[model samples]
Target: MSFTSARPEDLLIDAARRGDVPYLQQLLADGTVDVNVQNGKGFTALIVAAYDDQVEATKALLAAGADPNVQDVSGNSALMGVSFKGYPEVARLLIQHGADLNQQNGNGGTALMFATLFGRHNIVPILLEAGADTTIRDVRGLSARDLAVQQGNEEALKLLPQE
Candidate 1:
């Protein structure tokens, strides 16, 4: 069935969340789903795909001009979502497409911080490679290294390049 604009845009978002590539492609090709539409949770199709670790689906959205850097209502970008979820492949794709790693969320937590705090060791390198500043502090003035220490994640702590 053809997707309708009244479908809340989140249906396509949900499809992405499920990694339903074919359905998502169908929706994208239908010419009705807003590529940049945000759901009630402030998640866009790209964000959902990244969080789902749907690398192919995320690439498809990015190729179709989805804004990888589009922040949710809380200022969390797709990169942050993926990083927090520990999806290195998805995070890499977002970064390769120009996702800003240093962008902070409503809580002033950068993607690097989220990755470190969540023990996403792999994502730490991806964010750093994307030009994420290790020195950037969160609202509490805690850098990624500090958060890693607090979380007792030695692996994540090792990702921080010494200043």
Candidate 2:
């Protein structure tokens, strides 16, 4: 897929950020815009949808074969972003489509760690069910459960799998 530049893909991404599902769908169906195209920062359609909290857009991108595990320049995947933002449905969809459950982000934080740190108790069980590594230690050797306990997030602590 050749292009004059990333202009067209940028427009498609903007539409996705605004939750313009129809326009995004049209652009995707037209096949002119690269479904997996990343912007200057390496954020794909799925990443944009997850960032903007557009559940339908995320689902569409995934169904269109967007690689859920693709990372941006900063190594942030859609699952990590969704988990951080506490978007359960979107996270579920991404996981259903094979998003890496144990993928660590640029900061060496997994989706489980992000969910726990952000107090997204609802997202923990989902991540665990999707096989997120409970024993993953970040650069500081802090697991998700450890972070939750350190932050005094009792809710997240209850949701995390015990060692």
Candidate 3:
């Protein structure tokens, strides 16, 4: 059987993924789309926008009341996605919208861990300043500082607090 077409709410996610700010705005204005709707993977529009580096879209979603702390199936939040992708502006927006800095993913990885793992030096300090707990260990037993050391990210290591 042929699957049905996309729903209007799904369009919000699509628009956010494509960075189509105008379309996303229109969808929000219609008031039919739930800003916090999750896709098959459990990702909200804000997470998709942040993952795609759509700064404007990310901002619009936050302004429309998207939950910055919403996680996907893997427990990865919008902040983690932006942090991993090195989207500092999007990361900032997520944080400002009340994202839990210490929220851990399925692997127990926080935004700080993602930022450090990907060598996102610019984002590292931002997370640190936001009070991201460096002591939190991932499922692999690696803290953000540990990951920085493992990745040979000297700058990140320098920024991390010594154990």
Candidate with the greatest lDDT versus the true structure: 3
Location of the lowest summed lDDT over 10 successive residues in candidate 1: 2-11
TM-scores for every predicted model: 0.90, 0.91, 0.94
> Taking the tens digit of each residue's C-alpha lDDT, what string does model 2 give over 6-124?
57698778877887888888888888888889988999978998888998888778878889999999888999998988989999899889999999877789999999999988898
lDDT of each: 0.86, 0.87, 0.91
| Per-residue lDDT of candidate 1, residues 1-163 (tens digit) | 9754548487688787788778888888898888888978788999988987888889888988899889899899998988888998888888888898788898889999998999888888878877899999988989899998899989987778765
Give the CA lDDT, 0 to 100, for residue 155 in model 3: 94
The predicted structure with the larger TM-score, 1 or 2, is 2
For model 2, the stretches where C-alpha displacement exceeds 4 angstroms are 1-6
Every candidate's CA RMSD: 3.2, 3.9, 1.9
TM-score winner, 2 or 3: 3
Candidate 1 wrong stretches, greater than 4 Å = 1-8
What's the residue-level lDDT of 103 in candidate 3? 98
Q: Which candidate, 1 or 3, has the higher lDDT? A: 3
